[model samples]
Target: MDEQQRLAYWRANTALIRNLLIVWALVSLVFSILLVETLNKIQFFGVPFGFWMAQQGSILVFVVLIFIYAFQMDKLDQKYNNKK
Candidate 1:
């Protein structure tokens, strides 16, 4: 890849990472902590939503995010001719 392609690839990569991090923070911090009181008003299965988020929701989201990152990065790699 030339200089321009390299720069664009890195930019796209960083943007993907940034967006994923934002989602991670929103799920792990905002939903599980800041919005706990409001979320608790709702129920997930038999448990309170807030309690579920703190106990399991965040972990589930994290795992899903990992898969999403891997999937997206694979596409990104193909786009940049960087596939393994």
Candidate 2:
């Protein structure tokens, strides 16, 4: 890739990473910690929603995000002719 192409790819990759990190932070910090109390008012599978989020929801979200990132990056790679 040319220098300009490399720079564009880098910027696109950075943007994707930044967006995913934001989602991760929202799930891990906001839902698991900050909103735990309010979420606990709801129940799922006999467990408090907040407790579930703290224990499992964030993990699930992270896994999902990983898949999403991989899928998106594949498209990005194709767009940039970097796919292998």
Candidate 3:
């Protein structure tokens, strides 16, 4: 690819990674810690929202999001001939 294309690809990849990281961080820190008090008042599936988020929900979401990101990035890599 040309310099411009290379720059664009890197920018896009960086943005995607950054956004995902922010989302993961929010789910981990905000819902899990920062808002735990308010979240404790809510319930989901017979468990406190904060408890579920800290122990299970966030981890599950992170796992699913990471796999989705990996799959999408693999396709992006293939499109850009970045994959062997």
Candidate 4:
């Protein structure tokens, strides 16, 4: 790829990472921690929503995010013609 293409690819990659990290932080920090008191009032599978999020939901979301990141990166690679 040319220098311009290289810059664009990096930019897209960085944006993807930023967006994913934002989602991770919101799930891990906001709903799980900051809003726990309020969220505890809600139910999820017979458990408190906040507790479920803190104990399992966050981990599940993180794992899902990993797959999403991989999938998105693959698309980005294809878009940038980075395949070997």
Candidate 5:
């Protein structure tokens, strides 16, 4: 690819990373402080929704997000290198 294509690819990659980070932050905030009472109204197999989110859901999402970001970025890197 030419320089213009490379720049576009990088920009797209950066946007994906930023969007994922925002989603991660929102999930963290929801579990940590924002929607505790509303979340508590919904039960997950006898567990309080808020408590479950705080204790496990957020962590799981974060871990999954990390893997997803890593995998996507790795693919982008491989593509860029292959073009050379």
Candidate 6:
């Protein structure tokens, strides 16, 4: 790829990463800690939502985010002609 194409690809990749990181942080930190009191007022599958998030929900969200990131990055790669 040309220099411009490389730069574009890098920028796209960085943006994708940034978005995914934000989601991860929100799930792992905000849902599990900052919003725990409010979330605990609700129940999910018989467990407090905040407790679930602290124990398992964040993990599940992280896994899902990984998949989403991979899928989006694949599209970005194709868009930038950087696919392997």
Q: Which candidate's TM-score is highest?
A: 4
Highest-scoring model, lDDT: 4
- What are the models' TM-scores? 0.95, 0.92, 0.89, 0.97, 0.80, 0.91
Per-residue accuracy of model 6 over 1-84 as CA lDDT, tens digit each: 899999988998898899899998899889999999999999999999999999999999999998998899888878877846
Query: Ten-residue segment with the worst summed lDDT in candidate 3?
Result: 75-84
For residues 1-84, what per-residue lDDT tens digits would candidate 3 score against the true structure? 788877877887888889889999999999999998899999999999999999998989899888978987887787677755
Q: RMSD for each model, in Å, please?
A: 0.9, 1.1, 1.3, 0.7, 2.3, 1.2
lDDT of 3: 0.88
- Model 2 alpha-carbon miss at residue 58, Å: 0.8
Q: How much lDDT does candidate 6 score?
A: 0.91
lDDT of each: 0.94, 0.96, 0.88, 0.96, 0.85, 0.91
List candidate 3 stretches off by more than 4 Å: none
lDDT of 4 by residue, 40-64 (tens): 9999999999999999999999999
- Please identify model 2 stretches exceeding 4 Å from their true place: none
Ten-residue stretch with the least lDDT total in model 5: 75-84
Residue 53, model 5, lDDT: 88
lDDT ranking, high to low: 4, 2, 1, 6, 3, 5
Please give the TM-score that candidate 2 achieves against the real structure.
0.92
- Scored by lDDT, model 5 comes in at 0.85
Quote the lDDT for 68 in model 6.
95
Candidate 5 lDDT over residue span 1-84, tens digit each: 789878978897999889998988888896646997789899997998988888888999999999999898888878677444
Q: For model 3, which pairs clash?
A: none
lDDT agreement of model 2 with the native: 0.96
